[model samples]
Target: MTDLTIRARIREASNATFLADLDGEAVVYKPVEGERPLWDFPDGTLAGREVAAFLVSEAFGWSVVPPTWLGDGPFGPGMVQRWQDIDPEQDAVDIVAPDVAEAPDSGWLPVLEAIDEHEQPVTLVHEDTEQLRRMAVFDTVVNNADRKGGHVLAMPDGHRYGVDHGLTFHVEHKLRTVLWGWIGEPLTPDELEGVDRVSEALRGDLGRALEEHLTPQEIDTLGARCAALRAVGIFPPPPGHGPAVPWPLF
Candidate 1:
């Protein structure tokens, strides 16, 4: 076990978040005691949910979410995750509101159009990349409730990392995200294979690991989602009633 030590506090987060060192490695720490209570999720369970997201990502053989684990920190028990340094110059996912008459050529997918502060129309756009598509698939399987654009981290090496996965794995459906570009698209053969791997893992080791963090019902529902997605073989559309997109998208 690595010895984790708090180095600094991250003030930008809604809840208490810390920057720490684990066995000489830099990591972000989110203590359960510092988590704000949510009406939907049980009290002090957000940290566990974050780790659960990591476990699911690893199971899929998709390193979309950063490496995370449950451990003791300066603030008590919490989730510790390896820090990913994002490239400042380029963003894998970005918002573009070009003032041109017609939309730009290709590579971008329009998410929504809104009126700017100047009353001019603006269009929100994200890159059409395989990395982002994988993340969207991961979000669906994990039942990620909050997938704001800001949560996507673009590495200098072209790899994308996702963070802040505290709201996930609800027994009831809850998948709020900004990645609607691939909605209704058929899952690739590799993606389907990943889903199958997860389904099998959930019946064994992954299930046991999650049981320590989540309720039995939540784990069961997670397996059911895997089966349903495999059966459908298509990216699902947002539910009819609730909000499918997250607020403050970036």
Candidate 2:
């Protein structure tokens, strides 16, 4: 692995994150030593989860996550992912006033309604696009527990990329996310095919690759999630026991 030179710290991130120069390209580096222990997730495993998510995204062939790998950085071993240059004018997911959400040409699907600061009504919505729908399916297969709106990067050419995947791949059901707009909708053929590809890959090389990052049980559960999606052929409904979406939606 090439040495990553620290450029700056990403203070907004919950875990210790940094912007670093890997060769001549910019990348986001989250060192294992900087990980905060979570009661549910094993300590120092968040970096591995990020790498695992990237591998699964690649297997799906959707580019939902940027290129990511586990490598040694200035701080120590960590997850390094290519940095995305997002478009400021576009938002794949957003919070908008009810009237904007109600517009027929708005091209957004309302997921939730709530009062904003100043006691105003607002709707949590995301664009009705195939890219986002693919991401939703990817999240489901990985059992992502923290898919915040801010995590979806809207690129200049309109490609959507997701980040912050530390909370994922639990042995149990823990799918909490903001991309519930397609709940109960039948899966498109392309989406189903992607799931099928992942399911098949899990039985061979992909499964072996993930063993470096995930436990045997977690990997098994991941395969089961893929099978369940293939069986249902629909976007899954949110969990009945826990909160359906992550807080601070944006």
Candidate 3:
């Protein structure tokens, strides 16, 4: 774990999470407190996600959202991550409730339906589809096995960024996400430009740069994914197995 200074414990919840102003800034914290590890979630396999955070952060020039290892979580060693306000009170838009997907009461299964029910304001100025594509590229680059809708966090500013990278850098081709709005749509010229840049960058120096964060198999998969996207373009058909999207994406 990277070195850190604990400023304060923000709150105590089921996850025993807190907010630390590490190095003089506010960051979200989810500390391990008990033996009940967050073993319920399918992926987001902790250690692997930290590496995924590194790779994705480097791939896109966006702020990387990762958990900081403060100590043991409720079950074992825990981590604190960057905190982002999904909805700011100053804004007229209620990023929660009406817009945000309701939590599944029965369990996590209804999360998908709730996510589908939540309405995302499609304005002329903001284009969510474009944002999803960039994230899709990042997902492919990291070989994120679980690219669920809950992972995709829409910021107040309109940037659609993804989180939860524990199940990343897999050797297999497991790039599942909920942003299939552009499945049949062609990659826009601007979007293609970014893809082209990444494609060229992944060949030599950039690929080498990511070497430390990714394993041999992971790196090879990244290169292959890039080639595949270039040849077939970004959109592809859905998977054959379980829910391709994350459950209860709010």
Best model per lDDT = 2
User: Model-by-model lDDT, in order?
Assistant: 0.87, 0.94, 0.52
Judge candidate 1 at residue 224 and give its lDDT.
Answer: 92
Q: lDDT, candidate 1, residue 222?
A: 93
Q: In model 2, state the lDDT of residue 86.
A: 99
Query: How many residue pairs clash per model?
Result: 0, 0, 18
List where candidate 2 sits over 4 angstroms from the true fold.
none
**Reference-based TM-score of each model:** 0.94, 0.98, 0.62
**Candidate maximizing TM-score:** 2
Error of 3 at 142 (Å): 2.6
- For residues 1-250, write the lDDT of model 1, one tens digit per residue: 3478889999988899999998888999999889999999973388998998999999999899899998988778888899988899876656656653135565777667788788877776667788888898899999999999889998998888999999999988899988888778899998999999999999899999998888988899999999999999998989887988888888
Note each model's CA RMSD in angstroms. 1.9, 1.0, 8.1
